[model samples]
Target: YFQSHPAIQPATVVVEDRAHPSTSELSPTWNRTDEWYNYRSNPRERVHVLAALDESSYTGGTMNGDHPIAWCQDYQGGRAFYTGLGHTKESYADPAFRGHLLGGIRYATGHTQADCRPENGYRPLFDGTAESLADWKQAGPGSFTRSDDGTLTSSGGMGMLWYPGQDLGSYSLKLDWKMASASGDDNSGVFVGFPPSDDPWSAVDNGYEIQIDATDVPEKTTGSVYGFRSADLKKRDRALNPPGEWNTYEIR
Candidate 1:
């Protein structure tokens, strides 16, 4: 079906092998160990993929580890796609699943990209700047310190520093952020498509938050389209690096 559709051509596919010990090895108990049994050796591995999706529901789950569940880094000015949905034969055979898969392929292949910018727009209030850090006074005592590497670090508050002189709606915004640890709650994100507003809270309720929490229960973890969608990736047992170790995240 994908080959015949030129709109979906030029695609890339990834498959995870359960037979591999890293993912296939079984533990005696489900609760104590970080493995699920029923779907352990399913030829297709459907259960494993579904479990990852289900975990994407809250905040923290199997994703708090150092390893990334799954990722796609090839950007060619088209759509980027991923799916932890290749675990079972039945899953592959399902029409609904196929439809979504095909749609993603088409979109990623540049068959469809939405255009939704306002003709006359509001200017952004906080262009990421050293000065914008001053407005964060009321968001609950936070401090910004210049790192040896020149990246500004903030503690105990929530705010955004827009890049100075960045024109809205023309260029895409990208940045890397990670939690200080793997088990505690950390709140931060790159706010995009923000409308000029007096406070950051306005952006929280209005714009899109590319969430950066490393300890969110499940559905709210790193890479999640906060409150709206989840990244389709696998669950891996890897811990985030120690505090002060930088983890790079890019959003465009």
Candidate 2:
């Protein structure tokens, strides 16, 4: 079910699933050259699309306006990943492209974890704006500082920042994070399924924390359902980027 433009051309690659390891390190929009491919039927109904070609940036596109170039899915008992990238010899030598290929390989080989469920219509809880923090309340000592780049950095934190909006039931939360410390010795977490409370400990007692301390024990380290079950360490390690590099989390 493959169709393509006759000649290799430059196209803008738009990242759709930044939470996927294969696309986590990519910018929202990037330019690359490839023999753009189209399918007889859009696979968005089946696989989770990681990236797509921006048809407006190029001349020939057979799939109308939507053309997915990279995707992943769960197979019989394993996994499958596909990408229209790496069509040129230079693609293999590009660090970013190599990392993308490695991530896909890791996912397909069961060395990393990714939520390959088809995603659609996600509303933003925090859209990285100073105005978005209006409904959020800080509990305890430390607070987060909003930067000019639309990022919130934690400082002097023995506390927690939470949203006290409508209760979320059956939801998916996605966020990008990076440790400021070169040593990767930062401690933090995203608490979920908690009730409204002024005390940060309320979350610890009533809900779960997706822990984010890489130096801690398995049960308390990154990807762990804090103090309850440990994540697959091998998979987590493979999925985790080093400190100072961004990582995306998809918590459902």
Q: What residue pairs clash in candidate 2, if any at all?
A: none
Estimate the TM-score of every prediction: 0.40, 0.69
Give all candidates' CA lDDT scores.
0.40, 0.83
lDDT of 1 by residue, 130-154 (tens): 4654544333245566543324566
Report the Cα lDDT for candidate 1: 0.40
The Cα error of candidate 2 at residue 162, in Å, is 3.4
Clashes of each: 25, 0
